[model samples]
Target: MTGRLKDKVVLITGAASGIGEHTARLFASEGALVVISDINAAAGERLARELGMHFIAADVSKEEEVERAVSSTVGWHGRLDCMVNNAGMVGVVGSILETGAEDWRRTLSVLLDSVFFGIKHAGRQMRELGGGGVILSLSSLAGLVGGVGPQVYSVAKAGVIALTRGAASELSAYGIRVNAVAPGLVMTPLVEEVYGGHDAALRGGAAKSPLGSAAMPQEIAASLCYLASDEARHVSAHTLVIDSGVSAAGAGAAPQFHHQPADFLGRLPEQYQ
Candidate 1:
């Protein structure tokens, strides 16, 4: 209710749940005319009703649907102020050896291609409106390093980073800012399911980082809000990392200290050992 984004028009993909859902709610509270887009019609409609925002059922992987969603938002609000390309999936879980072409393509389509579509269409609308807009995509710590996620998922996220930078370079003249948020371990319902339950997911996430905790959806949402609001008017082409120091520590560097044995330093000098 701070009104940081007052009167702004925002569209969030995959906003039926997780980080997208949280960001949509946060944006709405701050006075943005929010549009919730997701393939989950049931949840999307329910959330739209709850927040008094419009809901569009669009599978972001398809260019046509993404185009329609953006057009619909602009048609309703007369301009698109912000586009959050937040839809994502873990995709095939195995290494490249076990991954199929279909799975790889699907992952890229959802995670990478969708961002391009959003930026392209939103940028067009913003150019027409003559007011600068912002584009934010959800990236991952896995994109910046290895072994943090499945190979294909990491690859798609890496593409998002590159897309953000390239688009920012080209779109800055029109007053549009392109950026991304690279989150490490976030405790959402999707992650809870993957870890078998909420408690287990929290424990697992906490064990991996220097902060001894994982980020909540709200934490990531706050970063999204800042990037979308006027407070970040000068920010562009940046991938804000909100990973509880996990990425800085190189993903689980803290755990290495816990796994060492008392005699692990046997080769060291006697006094040091």
Candidate 2:
């Protein structure tokens, strides 16, 4: 896979941590001149220093910031080859009623509005570069299934998926490919923060999955690389779900919980003891 992205210039948002950081490093490793953008100046700069890539501190939801990020990359590298709109915030985990209006709006702005702006700005640059470009978004499987995510988070991601398809359809004429990756529970820092700072949620998510494991950020990055590379030239206006068979299983399935009688002895809770 060496040189799959060689000499390409990419701009990735949320490049300070988690999947975004992983993708930035991976893209650089594969020979792309990556422009890592994030709100976290320290983390983003640290990553840029470590990877020998450029760092831009920008909030993707804002038009000016996003334009600057895009413009800086083109100015530095001469052209933009890909844009990974990965910056976003998960809504507070609760039922629709329990979620506040402000929380909802904030989540939408970061998660949904950011993608909208990324495409609007990045698409323009790709067009300016004469149209051999790819735009891959970090949507989630939560967008595909009903009742899978916190209300606002899922809605925003669903919008990302729809946005991806529409962008692909319209941009194909310009030689730009738009696509999304819908990943299931990966052990990212954001996920850890959302799950109360323990590995329990990730472990539980993995245990319940058919593969009995969670994907590493690098695994997701590999798929992203394929989409950005010439290998997937015809792949456009599509979303690739990378869940470990979680999307394929029924809600009632309990096969993972089954245990032999000899292994089934249970202990009382500590509180009860």
| Model 1: ten consecutive residues of lowest lDDT | 264-273
Q: In terms of TM-score, which candidate is strongest?
A: 1
Worst 10 residues of 2 by lDDT: 263-272
Candidate 2 clashing pairs?
none
Candidate 2 to truth, TM: 0.89
State the lDDT at 79 in candidate 2. 93
Model 1's C-alpha root-mean-square deviation from the true structure amounts to: 10.4
- Model 1, 177-200: lDDT tens digits are 999999998998878876889999
Model 1: what TM-score? 0.91
Q: Each candidate's lDDT (Cα)?
A: 0.86, 0.82
Off by over 4 Å in 2: 251-273
Q: Write the per-residue lDDT of candidate 2 for residues 1-273, one digit (tens) a residue.
A: 488899989999998988998898889888899999998888999999998889999976677899899999999999999999998766445556555676567668788988988998889998877957999999997788765566676889999999999999989988999999999878787666545664776786677568988778888988999999999999999999988887888433332222212111122112111
